[model samples]
Target: MDKQNSRFRWVVFFSVLFTYLLMSSQRTAPGLITEQVMKDFDVTATTIGLLTSMQFFVYTSLQIPMGILADRFGPNFFLIIGAIVTGVGTIIYSLGTHEFVLFFARILTGIGDATIWVNLVLILGQWFKVKEFVRLIGFAGMTGSLGFLLATVPFSAWIDLLGWRAAFFSAGIALCLTGILLYIVLVKKPRQLFHNESVPVKDEIQPQNVRMLLKRIVSNRQAWALFFCHFGVVGVYVGFISSWAVPMG
Candidate 1:
């Protein structure tokens, strides 16, 4: 990366960082709005459970396909589309009347959110050195956690003042703007400047490679071991935080 592009890498990082902030809000928003959702939708725990689960269901299911799309079309494609779809879905969620519509909105939001984390991983790979990747991810995790923190009291205050619809509506608009920021700042398959410039050239990212990637991942014993651990920890943890935590509150 030249000086201009080097500066823009941080810009790209922050853009994705901000996108993660809103993505966290979307993930945790249902928890915060449990009571409001229950009252407004006039539904019981089961409906709310299903509604909340809808997002995660789509989110989890789309990971492979999303990963393939990101690699094939470029991470920028997913990043841009993800933000746009998420924003639109959030707006729909805020405006939704019926349970079914809300369900689809949540699912759509999940699809959009699904594109994000993986795309960020790809972006980190494109911009930073391999050794720096983990640290950048750690920082990204911290930034995302900030959104979770905001989703608590500050978000509650927004709902208290504006009501859930207006609050979510505003967030949706912000998400859309974030998408535009991504379009402006994020370069598609940017040259790996954070790494050794003399590193050998590599094949282009392509759709066919996705199959090999999956095969490699599945064949790795350590990957399976870590998969089980992540499944038990992250899956349960996210499910609870994204769904049950607010109602518990």
Candidate 2:
């Protein structure tokens, strides 16, 4: 039984990792096909800039709302729903002719991508204790890094052979299927896994009721300092890479 349980946990971990890979692929798809998009839409660099910019805009704006939904409705629910929405958006993007449609599709994809990191973190917190947190998160980060690595080379190869639309179509299908699987396989808490163990009954944690929690978190000086440090470091790194790397290529 212990072996079976361990196997089950590993399966769940890999499934979540696969979902993250798909999310990363979707996020980077536009960058992979920037030249094709520019030619097909007959757009200037500025327009392409704006379309991609919308992705970041939507992702940043939706973070808080996605967190709330994940906490209130459960991460699996929102993550799966987000994946479906993202897959639909990718399909629409592949079929899109006009710039407006493309922009809309990008926005949807961004919203979908926004659900991934937060929900995964929340899920990890539920499954692993504090002692295991760093190691598990490191493993998750490695998965994300692998996804990014795949996006650059393997993804480009697929786009070259199949064309961007076909590539996106395949990706969309994968995301949709994975989302369904996650919804079916994922349980909200550890107690849900034990057949004989009595389930703990607790009040549903509402987003609105989280104001006090938020207040406590925000009032922590260390938290504020950590937030700014992360924001400054990550922001600078991502911004520099996003702006400079493609141009250098």
Candidate 3:
């Protein structure tokens, strides 16, 4: 039973990993569609910048709050919600004929994207031992890299064949289907799946401790170093690879 349960956890991990892949894919998808978007909306690159930034801005703004909520509740609920919202956003973006609709779709996508990674961390932590968790996270990072690569050449080819609307609409449907698969396969706890009576529920963080939590995080030099490093690397990638490079080429 132990071995069987342990094997099943990998199934759950891959389900979430696939969702994370979709998240990263959509994050960089605008690069391929930039020309079509500009033509459709009769907008400048400046407006395109705003369209892209709207998703990032919302995703960044919601991270802390979503993390707290996911900790209090559970990640499974939020992950499902994220998948649905992301799919809807992509579908809306595909069908949108107006600038206002496009902006709204981007915001929705950002909100969904915001809920993914922190929840992924929570899910992985719950399901795996520390060493296994570390290795799985590295795999997750590789999955994201694959997503970025897919959003580039393959996604561009897709757009070229079907145009952006059909391509993105198909992507949206795929995301939603992946969410359904996640719903079926992801168990919040190993005990839940395996019927282990000895397993204990994890303690939830209290609301009042948030201030202290923030202070501790703010005071951590290592955290700040990581924050700056990630920010610099992501900033350059988003600014160049995901937005401008395609058009320049």
Index of the highest-TM-score prediction: 3
**What TM-score would every model get versus the actual structure?**
0.86, 0.82, 0.92
Using TM-score as the yardstick, the better of models 1 and 2 is 1
Q: Model 3: how far is 232 from its true place, Å?
A: 1.5
lDDT per residue for candidate 2 within 61-144, as digits (tens), equals 888888887777778778788788888888889899899999899888888888889998876665555767678888887776
Q: Model 1: how far is 224 from its true place, Å?
A: 2.5
Off-target runs (Cα >4 Å) in candidate 2 are 1-6, 187-197, 201-209, 221-233, 236-249
How accurate locally, in lDDT, is each candidate? 0.81, 0.75, 0.84
Q: Mind giving the per-residue lDDT tens digits that candidate 1 earns over 59-107?
A: 8899988877777778888888899899999999999999988998998
Q: Lowest lDDT 10-mer window, candidate 2?
A: 240-249
Error of 1 at 141 (Å): 2.6
Q: How many collisions per candidate? A: 0, 0, 0
Point out where model 1 deviates above 4 Å: 1-5, 187-200, 203-212, 247-249
Off by over 4 Å in 3: 1-5, 187-192, 195-198, 201-208, 247-249
After the best TM-score superposition of candidate 2, give how far the Cα of residue 191 lies from its true spot, in angstroms: 11
